[model samples]
Target chain A: MRRDVFQAIADPTRRAIIGLIAIQAMTPNALAEYFDTTRQAVSKHLQILTECEIVRQEQTGREIYYHFNPGKMKEVADFVEPFRQLWEKRFDQLDHVLRKIKTTKK
Target chain B: MRRDVFQAIADPTRRAIIGLIAIQAMTPNALAEYFDTTRQAVSKHLQILTECEIVRQEQTGREIYYHFNPGKMKEVADFVEPFRQLWEKRFDQLDHVLRKIKTTKK
Candidate 1:
């Protein structure tokens, strides 16, 4: 299967992992403590994240710390940025319609 | 599989579909013309997007037009907005470090 940042963040657990590691790096064992799953499952998710380069692993002694690569997340952010304007426009239109309805009611 | 905005936009083709429909509503047949896929394939992608409420279908006579629902994408935007600060901080730190390296070289 192809691994990309989009696929990396598609899972809720992986998003949780990103939220945690974005603050600080963690080993699979440490990350697993926060989830209701096994350490192995956490590791599997980390593996996918690493494959997509969303997280990078660094070996310090026997433990591998997974660090969130903010650069990869920039791609996801960039993808969503353009849509922000579209949504805001829709919201603005809705607000206008609501204001018109309010004037009619008055 | 659970359909969410993230999963809906994971595929490149689906992202393309969103971009095109954002400008103007299009039927699956019209959308397929932009891609190298059959109308049914485009409809399958549209199905996932519709399930996630990222796109809505309006039937005008025999043709069904898919309109991009910008509201669903706001969820995606909200998810990535917090991380924007993190990446910006990292970029700033990188710029600072680069300036220091340049000073040392000089």
Candidate 2:
């Protein structure tokens, strides 16, 4: 089953992992070293991120390098954009309505 | 403790709640009726969304109404914007480098 991008991003460790890899591509071990958790824990987080397509991994020789995948994140932005725009428009309409009410009140 | 916006958005039910309220404001019970779960369960989900500031509530007479809070969600967008831009720039740079490599090979 496919997971929603929001569900994929809900973990603090996953967000931190995204942040680390966003700065520069790094081998899984190198990324693991920065956190106090075991390498396996980091690997698990990376796996979820990869499954979500939020991060992509490339194997070069013997090492796997993880990098941020911005295109995938555009999926997230697209998901929320409509709602964001809707609320903005609603607020604008509310403002107009309020103004009208004020004018009529006076 | 402050929760990351990503962490706040990670649940499917929460995302669904966000979607429902994005369309129109509704009372907690009215929102609960749409789901198979108990009202208390829905209430719990709404509590989390409210805590994250992703949803806001207003009491009208005897009922509380829930509405989407767009301004709070801007925080999530802002959090991810830097990383998204960074990756796009990196990918553009990579494309340039790849073109140079192709020309050199030619």
DockQ of each: 0.31, 0.28
Candidate 1 residue pairs in backbone clash: none
Please give the clash total of every predicted structure, in order. Answer: 0, 0
Judge the docking of candidate 1 as incorrect, acceptable, medium or high.
Answer: acceptable
lDDT of 1 at B60: 100
RMSD (Å) of each candidate, 1 decimal: 11.1, 9.5
lDDT of 2 by residue, B4-106 (tens): 5566677766777776776678888998888888889999888888888888899999999998887777766655555555445655555454444334321
Candidate 1 chain A: minimum summed lDDT over ten consecutive residues — where? A97-106
For candidate 1 chain B, the 10 contiguous residues with the lowest summed lDDT are B97-106
Task: Give the clashing residue pairs of candidate 2, or none.
Answer: none
TM-score of 2: 0.76
Q: Which regions in candidate 1 have their CA more than 4 angstroms from the true location?
A: A91-106, B91-106
For all predicted structures, in order, the TM-scores are: 0.82, 0.76
**lDDT tens per residue, model 1, B1-106:** 8888888888989988887787678999999998898999999999999999999999999999999888998887767766665677774555454444334321
- DockQ, Cα level, model 2: 0.28
The C-alpha interface RMSD of every prediction is 7.9, 7.4
